[model samples]
Target: MPQAQKGICAEPNLHALYLMFNVHEDHDEEVRRILAQILNIFDHYDDEHYEAMVSGVIAIGSNYWMELYPGFLPAELAPFPDMHCEDRHAPVVPCDLFIQMRADRADICHAMGTAVYDALKPHVELVEQIKGFRFLDGRDLTGFVDGTENPKGMHKLDVAIIGDEDPEFAGGSYIHIQRYRHNLSKWNQLDVPHQEEIFGRTKTDDIEFASEMKKPFAHTKRTNLKDANGNSIEILRQSMPYGDMKEQGLFFVSCAKSPQPFTKMLESMIFGDAHGNYDKLMDYTTAETGAAFFAPSVDFLKFQGMS
Candidate 1:
């Protein structure tokens, strides 16, 4: 098996930096050089305390993948599609490249982010950057624990890393990212029971509702998708809460063997079930940015020469 990125299955970090960039129209060659340089730095970084992962967009208009991998691309790779419902919209804003850095300390994450920005200075323009931190016991700003249903142990590897299904891209993972801004004032106005009904779980105890008791439009129910055979589809969530007094919400990060699970979940959230009710969580939060990228194996990056 090819070596996967260290951060995919690593323990959750206390601090993270999410960076997205678009290459200059005529500077594709220069951007490639910068990728190799940044990868070299990641190669020597201490994974015990910090982790870095990189990815490039694979759509037709983006030359990053064509110039590097040529004919090989993740089977499900595509530009993120916009989502709309009766009252809300999730817009698609694709970027050419993405870099994520995580560490236990804020200073370490900052230093790594600065190094990456310096390397790509001349070739790329920043699209979005977010600093995320783990909230109390990994809860979101809404006062409920996040990622309670994520796969654990070896199951995480099974759910996240590409295997025999796509042998050529084995060990790679498809990633989806979005930034959500919360309406804390509106959310805070609701009682605890009302909030729990929206999430389908008890806020204080983190206990999920029984299947029969779950509402059709509850967040947990809407997002939990199953395959045709009735087996549950899973995705590794590395999301974290971000904000200040002015802005606060989640920087959603999801990794999977393929993009199907993430795409399906998003559709369900934005459009709702056959009954036509969407996720109530959206009523309290607004999606500001959405994009998709493919994070390749470490071995692939080391050998694919951009110079």
Candidate 2:
């Protein structure tokens, strides 16, 4: 495998900064070089502040990839599967670039984010910039552990980084992101037992409900998918919660070798199964933004991004 972006499989960090941008017309080449330099800025700061554990990943939006690279695209690269059922919705709000910066220190994240913003502002329109932090020991703002089923150790590479099937894009990862705004007012009205039933787990202990006892609409039941062969399908999650007193929600990030798993899980959440039993958690959270990108191996940025 090629050298993957460090941030793709890095351990959970205390702070994160996410930025989305659209390149100006006739500036694809310039933006590519700028993106490459932003990665270098991340590496320079990470080396200088090793204890901060700084890491970053830069990705190209599916719709903009061809314009920038003028080369082959990732085989599985595709746009966000915008799906809706009744009141629940997943809409597409695309971007040309996505930069992710994470570190143990907020200051480092700020510095790196600033560096990236400074470098690319002249050639790109900033669509979004959200800073996130570790919330109560990696729990979502919803008071439940997030990424509980995320692949661990080397398994993360197996799950997230493209391999021999797409040799040219090996070490790259397909990304899907959503900005979910929670309706805490409505959700808080529910008792602890009701919340646990929706999540399919014990709140205090984070224990899963037994198969016989799991609800058809439980979150875990909807997202914990299986393949035709009865094997578990997985995505490596790097999500974090963001926002302030006025509003708050999860900045959901899912990376995988292929985009199919993310789409399937999302469909299951909104459209549900043949019985039309949707994920109960969707009732309390609104996915306000969604997009797809492919973070190529660092080697691609080093060579192709500069070319």
Any idea how many clashes model 2 has?
0
Best by TM-score: 2
**Candidate 2 error regions (>4 Å):** none
**How far is 105's C-alpha from truth in model 1 (Å)?**
0.5
Q: Each prediction's TM-score against the native?
A: 0.92, 0.99
What residue pairs clash in candidate 2, if any at all? Answer: none
**Tens digits of per-residue lDDT for model 1 on 1-307?**
9988777777788888888888777876666556666766555455434343322211112225664467777777776767888777887777888888777778777877898899888877888889999999989999999999999999999999999998888888888888999999999999999999999999999999997898898999998889899999889998999999899999998888988898899999989988887899999999998888788876666566443
Worst 10 residues of 1 by lDDT: 54-63
Task: Report how far off residue 110 is in candidate 2 (Å).
Answer: 0.7
Which residue pairs does candidate 1 place in steric collision? none
**lDDT at residue 150 of model 1 (Cα atoms):** 95
